[model samples]
Target: MFKAIADPTRRQILGILRGGRRTVGEIADNFEMSRPAVSKHLRLLRSAGLVVTRKDGTASLCDLNAKPLRTIQDWLQDYEAFWSDTLHSLKKHMEEGQ
Candidate 1:
């Protein structure tokens, strides 16, 4: 899943799908890359379970899964306090230097 989202294009695709379901063409329209490139990103996302695609007649509709994101968020929560403390320490050091 992390590998799938490692690309900026894939991340943007997720953000776009967050608004609602979109057809493959709609997704490709937002990016400067070719439709095939966008399709490749979508394929990776689908493999990672970050997004699901369905056939709507001749068009493929994509929607954000979000469940994998919740898992990723839960894992990141473990480091939240460490980040907070580091930020606080940095702020204090800067203030003293000033």
Candidate 2:
């Protein structure tokens, strides 16, 4: 999952698709690469369960799958709390000195 989102192209594709579903050609238009390459990236995202595709007539509409992202969000919750507390402490000390 992390590997799928690690690529800049993949992230950009995900960002655009997050707004709504898009066909393969429509997604390929946003990138400078060939349709085959974008399709390849979409395949990786699909395999990771990050996105889902459904055939609509001649085009396939791709959409984000939130289940995997929810798992990632749950995993990061603890780290976010830890960082939030640490940042708060540092902010307090810096403010005290000012």
Candidate 3:
């Protein structure tokens, strides 16, 4: 899943989908790339379980599936406090020097 989001284009797509569901055409319009290229990114996102696609009549709507992101977030939580403490220590040291 991380591999899927490693691309700048794919990450941009996720940012757009975060706003709301969008049709393939709507997504393609936001990018300078061709429709097929956008579709390729969508395919990767779907494969990674990052987005879900549904057919509404003739249009395919893509929606963000943020469950995977939550998992990633949970995994990163352990580092948050460590970085916060490190930053605080650096600030204190700088203040002492001043």
Over the full model, what C-alpha lDDT does candidate 3 score relative to the true structure? Answer: 0.95
lDDT of 1 by residue, 1-98 (tens): 88988899999999999899999999999989999999999999999999999998999999999998888888888899889999999999999999
Against the correct fold, how does model 3 do in TM-score?
0.82
lDDT, candidates in the order shown: 0.95, 0.93, 0.95
What does candidate 2 score on TM?
0.82
Off by over 4 Å in 1: 86-98
Error of 2 at 23 (Å): 0.5
RMSD of each: 2.4, 2.2, 2.0
Ranking by lDDT: 3, 1, 2
Candidate 3 stretches with Cα past 4 Å from truth are 86-98
How well is each residue in 11-97 modelled by candidate 2, as lDDT tens digits? 998898889999999999998899999999999999999889999999999998868988888989989999999999999999999
Give the true-structure RMSD of model 1. Answer: 2.4
Residue pair clashes in candidate 2: none
